[model samples]
Target: MNSLNSPWAAHFIQTGAGNNQSFEQAGALTLENIKTLFAECDKPYSGLPPSALKKAIYSSDLSQVQPLEKVIEQTNRLIAKNSIMVQHPHCIAHLHTPPLISSVMAEFYIAALNQSMDSWDQASSATFLEQFIVDWLVQTFSLGADADGVFTSGGTQSNLMGLLLARDWFANTHSQHNIQQDGLPEYGHKMRIICSDKSHFTVQKSASLMGLGERAVVCVKTNQQGQMDIDELQQTIEALTAQDLLPIAVVATAGTTDHGAIDDLHGIVTLCRQYGLWSHIDGAYGGALMLSEKHKYRLKGIESADSVSVDFHKLFYQTISCGALLVKDKSNFSSLLYHADYLNREGDELPNLVDKSIATTKRFDALKMFMTLKSVGAQTLGEMYDKLIELSAQVADSVKENDHFELCCEPLLSTVLFRLSSHYQGSLSSGEFNQLHQTLRLQLLTSGDAVIAETKVNGKLYLKFTLLNPCLTLSDFDSLFAKIESHAKLLTNKAL
Candidate 1:
């Protein structure tokens, strides 16, 4: 068999799979490729239907597939044909952003090496590297003395780890037995978790997975800006106590997903301490802001948390599928530890990561993060954080200055919510107002000139922009708003 004729071999040769490109050269290549793909970058949409797009991708018949060179051409065409460009400055939806270019190159190395940090024997050097990065993150956050953690897929997994640990800790302390072996029989069903209404939905999902019912997550109210109200939190805890429910943990969010609002961390920490509740800070979205000394103050008292969740992909400039759950005590892994003779033959073996994580085979995600921080230095990353926050403020200013849009909330971190201004403020029926907001969002998506986000607030439609790209400037917002306004006017015309 001619190896050159093998599709896999042909693909590798065609794409230079085994060849490494220097950072400078790769970056230039990426830029050139991007320019070539998006020839008319200013176009509003790709103008391709879902069926047509699927047909194009599925056109590749492996049984009679063309040479790998043709596949590369198709791949480039796919990139050029999509409107979902997170790297573009005008993409202002959700927490999406352009990851650092250097980290992207590091990701290539990680993928090629394919290090699985499941156990020491399988990934000795990779395991140690991951451990070192985790230790550094623990120290950086000042989690606690002898704190430990592991990299995860993302915020949802990290959040789940925190909840799982909290559940095990509560179980072990109350039951005087191992929950992993004995289950939650000793602790009973009185255990519950608590978070603010603005907290990520993952908290509730995590609770349900931890054997606590979805209703077990008590929702504390928040202030006007979406910051969790300390008074309401305390009252909720007290009410739960009166009902004889054990409050297992308090989950404080450093940045709520909707508006990037930082909770009253100092106050929340104090209350957690007073109540003897395990405190977990869901800083997955905002934890990277700790890199910036100027804005680190917003996360004051976060150091008091028993555990913290941080997503490197969110702002650490790492690619997607990178997050961490840091614990104050190294021994917290005891609850999750599992042993088997076949896999645990080495007496001096370092702990298997599967014992610590929810998954068995985990990617070497720490490589990208470690390389990114080392290559760019913490100072540069911090500066990038500051720049994005400042850029978000600039976006808000643009919104306020324009007669077409209004600022819905003060950006507590790097998110801005606003909506098109309308004189039809005369209380339209709720149904009518919601209908308008829905129409506005659909209009923007179909336009595709500028990507935006929408979320419901107190039954009102609100457009949102999550600015996490340092490369974007206020001028980007000018175009973003101009497109939004143009589309919104069309909606208004249809309504009339």
Candidate 2:
């Protein structure tokens, strides 16, 4: 039977007719359910153990169909109730950011429209909107008139695209061979990509996926400040050449995960030019600094990079999974070009976004950034980021002053790495000291007092505070510290 005559007629969104009442009702209901759920949960998390949560989630019978209102209620009870509340002031664990209200509103429009970005016919206006945003990004980074970019899932996918283009470009320029058409060359095993030891793990992961194995990634050690040691980097590159290795590219990190150290971009780019290697700047975290007039100097020479990766979800306050990869030379994207008769025909004059991306059937993610830029404006976003950096510095100083905590180093962006003082450890062995920190973190999480992160630095445990929330103030952190101290004292007393 036709949908109009069937029982499901009310479920579909009807265009050209009056407003879809069902959609309006469902949207209002969902929003109310979410507000109620947030009001009931006071902590960043519900503090439910994995086993209990799993049992509660599976208790519902999925085979049974229910009305939209009932479905929303069940979802809140089972899923949203247990999910991490990233917007909470004390949820300072990862790079995740609380999405901006403007971007959140954009997400609703994005979902309702359901535009697929691969072809123009499926996303006519969306395709052009994405291009306009990309053009603006290219200009913001000073990537030249010939540059272009495409939105990606996040840093991982963007990094992969940079390396893929670098590999193909190197192969074609040097040996007149096309790696995409011919696969890895005979000397593929000798090809090497270089990055600092503090670079994201995605560098090695990309190398493995490219069929060069993990060994193809040559890591240069960092300096005392956690930045890539420029002198050591030069030595490493020279050593690789002496060993007859083919160094095709250098991935310079704009921000390290643990220390938030920004590498010397100009220094790295200079060396890359000297060696005739492709220079890629992985600015997934610190790229937002370009908006800050005060901190933009840290990203000097970024414009000279052959490619760059930026994530809006991190510091830009957009929703999750929104990032872009920009290339200095737009023609380099030819390596990823492919045609399909049904979707992106070769002779078609209309712009198809699939030609610039590794993904097809992509969501209209660019709309989120477009709306955010228009509503919030770039100047306000810059000031917000600057405030986060200032807060990190203040926290670091406070940690140094407290006898109970030991500051690892100064924060360059917004991450502070520190640990409990040795006096608090009471002559415990190295392993036990690390265990103490781990236990305290867990205790805080279980009590739902705070949600902090832990990482190892130089084989010693260090707690990390990734300050991404601009709304948070020093007073908020003071309270969080008091809870941490209480937890630590309880654990230490138990050990005694």
Candidate achieving the largest lDDT:
2
TM-score of each: 0.91, 0.98
- Candidate 1, superposed: residue stretches over 4 Å from native: 1-35, 38-40, 43-45, 55-63, 424-428
Model 2 residue 384 CA deviation in Å? 0.6
Lowest summed lDDT over 10 consecutive residues: which window, candidate 1? 10-19
The top-ranked prediction according to TM-score is: 2
Go through the candidates in order and give each one's C-alpha lDDT.
Answer: 0.79, 0.91
Question: Residue by residue across 456-481, what tens digits does model 2's lDDT show?
Answer: 98889998899999999999888888
Error of 2 at 314 (Å): 0.3
lDDT of 2: 0.91
**Local distance difference test, candidate 1:** 0.79
Q: Which segments of model 2 are wrong by more than 4 Å?
A: none
